[model samples]
Target: MTTLNACFRGQLGDFQLDFEFSIPSRGVTALFGPSGCGKTTLLRCIAGLNFLPEGKLEVDGEIWQNGKQFMPTHKRPIGYVFQEPGLFAHLNVKRNLTYGRRRAGIKSSNDNELHELTGLLGIDHLLERDIHALSGGEKQRVAIARALLMKPRLLLMDEPLSALDQDNKNEILPYLEQLHSHLEIPVIYVTHDRREVERLADHLLLLKEGSIIAKGEIGELLTRPDLPFGRAQDAVTVLDGQVRHYDARYGLSTLQIEGGTLEVPDQLGPTGVYKRLRIASTDVSLSHQEALNTTILNRLPAVIWKILPTDGPSLNILLRIGNMGEGSPLLASVTRKSVEQMALKEGQQVYAQIKGASLLGSSSTTQPRAHCMTPLIACE
Candidate 1:
């Protein structure tokens, strides 16, 4: 399997970073942490902007840096997108998009890639507009397109939507989803928002205080129970499903997932559209037996896979339905008192109750995997 290996030990002023980790070579891997956690610093290290003598970097099999050997930033096969578009104010969108390709000395007579990229970003119509005339979201889309045109082996995005308002952020997210589907190059996306991490990340790298706390698949990390991310009140599990049925009169949409059907709000989209559903652990309730008179819409028969102890009064349980290996892992956060009342234990069967309103939908392009395979790195 392809992978990007990174080992860096450095200090930026008062912050110290020492860790090594590997991420899959395709799909988005989010560098997530708090505001001062060295996310951007690490990103710059990978791009060769912040040269560290002790750093080591390798993508696939190519060595970009190690010891005394180092590749310059411009020479490295990387495309970087910052929080702001940073496009030339005097240039038109078309010009801005082509500048990277031209600078890279890449020649392509085929407008196929260009058309496909622009179409994926919803910027085909904006190509003729000047950079100054575009909205924040539009400019970011243009910036992303420009980076793609460079045909780099890796893409680095630094909070591309951080500067945009909610309306604009929503406008550009679908386009980012399209990139996830259409491109095979690896992406290192930096952000502090868990929502963005849930929607876009295939692999997750949790950085804190310049060190790695945990790194793995988003789903696995979110339900690990050992990680604080899994026990947070807003902790959620992402389920990949396709629209199975639509109820117009009741305004409900049913999604067919691996183990069972999930009924969400109907306005999600037409039948057959794939979506990533977010089910919060807090919204899930557990029962020893299935109830018939309950008002809850989604109830799945799950076997307790493992129960994890939280720092507080609550416990996080990982439940599996259907084939344990193939089923989407459901995380239910329940009180320790409830655990004693229900006599819940590993290997015991239970019912998972999920509310319809708790199911949040987002753009999904990839199929659900049995597990994410990000190699864990030990921190000193």
Candidate 2:
């Protein structure tokens, strides 16, 4: 499988950044960390904005930087979107979008491509409007469109929604989600927001103080009890499933996942359509036996994988959702008292009762290859 290989080591003032990893060359790869963890700095290094002396970046077998050779930022086929829209105040949306294409030496004959992109972003109607006349969300859509028009091999987004208010963030998320289904280029998204990672990312790179704490597929990393994400207060498990059946009378759709089936309260799509589901750890409960008379509709046999204490009086239980204990992962946050009373232990069989599960969005039927990260040694 094709991959993007990156390794960097450098110091800025008193802080140091050192890491190495490889992810699939398609789908969204999220760089997630808190402020000052060097998320943006790492992104800049990848974009050639920060030239590290000991850095090597290879995107899908093409070497951008290695040893003495380096690719200049302007020469690299990259599309960058910053926190701010960064649109030209003087130009209308149409002109602003076409500017990148024109600079890239693409002919105006590609207008059909432009129209298709604008339509996907829901920005075709705003093409005639001035930059100042657009809302925060609209302006960002235009910025995204402009970047895509460059026909980049890789796209870098450094908190593109950070400048927008909550309303604007909500407004643009759907369009951003649409890109997952349409775009073929690899996207490196930098954000501190876990919500964004859950909604958009296929792979995750967790960073802390310029170092990678963990890197893997989003689903696997999110449910690992050893990771902070699994014990987080807002921890959630993301599952990829295909719609198998829909009952219009109850407006419920049955989804088949790796381990078991889930019934969501919506008609997601026709049979065989893929969708992503988010189940909160708090919404899951475990019982030794399946309750046949319960109000809960989704229940699956699972094996207790791990039990760890959280920041509060709760314990986070990691479960493998199948009778044989070899299936997709699930997380349940239960009170410590409940665990002590039930005598739950690793490898024990139990039924996971899910109270609610939300549909993140439709996913591509063809899943991307899992990300592969090289182990890093400490750099002195």
Candidate 3:
């Protein structure tokens, strides 16, 4: 497998940043952490926007940065889309996108490629409009178009959606997913938003105080007890399954994951539509006895594994799925009172109630995976 590995160590004003990670030569590599966690600073260093003391950046065997022989930002081939859509107010949308076309090293512009990008981003009608006249979402789309139009070897995005509100983020997610599905170019996305990382990153780089804390696929890290951040938020177990059967009339999709069959919302088209479903631990419920008449469609029998105390007024229990293959696990968080009331214990049998619609993602590709399940786990 082609790998893009980077090793660097630098001190930025009292902050010493040291990050070393090797991501697959393709797909999104998400840099995730809390606010003021040096996610952006590291991204800048990689982009040559911020010069580090002793840094090295390599992509698919091409050296972009080293200790003293660092390549200038203008000289290196990188397409950067900043946090705020940094469009030129004086230029129109079309001009902003085509600006990089005239830059050195860019061979030529194909009218068809430009038209396709405009169409894909839903900016064909706004090409003639001024930058200031566009909405935040539109501006971001244009900025992304500009970056892709340059045909850089790698794409860098630093919290591209943070400036926008929730509605705007939703408006742009489909476009971002389309870009990932269609293009083969590698992307390094920096964000504090767990949802964004969960939906987009093929590899997860956990940063804390300007250093890497943990690095792995999204799925593996979510249930991992080693990392504090992965368990901080409501833990969502991502599952990749083929749309075994989609009953359009009933509005449900039967998915096969690992050794079990699951039912989720019928959002996919045909059979080949790979799906990444998120089942939050909170949404899952455990029953000590057999559930014969439960309304929940998914009630797979599970064996109790590790039951631990959560920081909140809850208990996080690790479950070994029955008939879903040995050792493969699922997570459930329930109240301590409920656990004691039911006398939940290890080696006990229980049914895991999973909702069909609780599964999130339009087939999340970048996030973590159990068996490298189509490489969906820690995503962009």
- In lDDT terms, which candidate is top? 2
lDDT (10s digit) by residue, model 2, range 135-228? 9999999999999999899999999999999999999998998887788888989998899999898889999998988988899999988899
Question: What residue pairs are clashing in model 1?
Answer: none
- Give candidate 1's whole-model lDDT: 0.81
Residue 236 lDDT in candidate 2 = 94
- Regions more than 4 Å wrong, model 1: 242-274, 295-297, 305-316, 322-326, 335-340, 345-347, 357-366, 369-371, 374-380
Question: Could you give the C-alpha RMSD of every candidate to the true structure, in order shown?
Answer: 3.3, 2.1, 4.1
lDDT of 1 by residue, 165-224 (tens): 999999998788877866778899999988998888878889989998888887777787
Count of residue pairs whose backbone atoms collide, per candidate? 0, 0, 21
**TM-score against truth, every candidate:** 0.87, 0.95, 0.88
- For residue 146, model 3's alpha carbon misses the true position, in angstroms, by 0.4
Candidate 3 is scored at a TM of 0.88
lDDT tens string, model 3, 1-380?
A: 54466776768788888777777756787899999888988888878888874778776677777677788888767789998998999999998988878755566546788999888888999999998899899999999999998887889998999999999999888788767766667788999888887777667789999888887777666666666633443766766666778787889888776657787765574675666667788878988665778778888888887786667888787777774326346778888899999999987878888754354545334322322312211211
Worst 10 residues of 1 by lDDT: 369-378
- The numbered model that scores best in TM-score is 2
lDDT score of residue 126 within candidate 1? 86
